[model samples]
Target: MNHMLLTVRQDANLTDNLVGVNAMEVLINALIKSGAQRSSLRAKAFGGARMVDGLSDIGEANAQFTLDFLESEGITCDGHSFGGTNARNIRFWPATGRVLQRMSTDRLIEPKTIVQAPPEGNDLELF
Candidate 1:
């Protein structure tokens, strides 16, 4: 079977708009609808970097959200590289659930220490 690759981008702000399509709910649903199974699916999560200076903890929130969502769905996240100042490029093979995470240093940005925000209402937007 051909492997499927999913890439989720980074959102600097934890907003309601960031949910929905970007949430793991949608990802898993899409995979299942396409005949992917949780037991057979392995996830490679990436790209939660604090890119902008003096910003809040959006990157960390995104990483946590991903973990929580996966855990809730009983999906195994076999690989992950998150919560860093540098951006990362990742590739995931859905067939075997193998993931490759690579960090980028060519265009690195300095991260600023910021406080995390409180979890608000249901930010997950299901499709």
Candidate 2:
């Protein structure tokens, strides 16, 4: 029941054609070298939470880039989780192709109580 699962972030510019060590091309090559057939390859992508406020949604952009890349490369994307304000924690099991995603939730933290020591008994009467 041993399998290899790879998770990596793509370059900000996917069209640049730069093959970085962690780039998709390298990942596919590594899989091939490890005896996986390209035709049978499948992917499950996660993350891309919109964590900021601005004109550009970087998270959505990255997620879209991944889908586009996989599509262009003829790879099947098994599933995806995308586009949310909350952060996400993803756990993927390659052998089972199972993905567990947990979204960030707001929780109120109770403040700790600070105890102050009483003044020393009359050691220094003068202030």
Q: Each prediction's Cα lDDT score?
A: 0.64, 0.66
Winning model by lDDT: 2
Error of 2 at 12 (Å): 2.6
Q: Please provide, for model 1 over 19-111, each residue's C-alpha lDDT reduced to its tens digit, 9 standing for 90 to 100.
A: 633655676677778886657666666767777667675777667777776677566766677777776777666566677777878555566
Candidate 2: stretches off by over 4 Å = 1-11, 14-22, 106-127
List TM-score per model, in order. Answer: 0.64, 0.67
Using TM-score, give the best candidate's number: 2
lDDT tens readout by residue for model 2, 1-127:
2233333333345453344224778888888898888888888877666565443556666777778778887888877877766666788777788878888894423346699987779676666
The alpha-carbon lDDT assigned to residue 23 of candidate 1 equals 58
Worst 10 residues of 1 by lDDT: 1-10
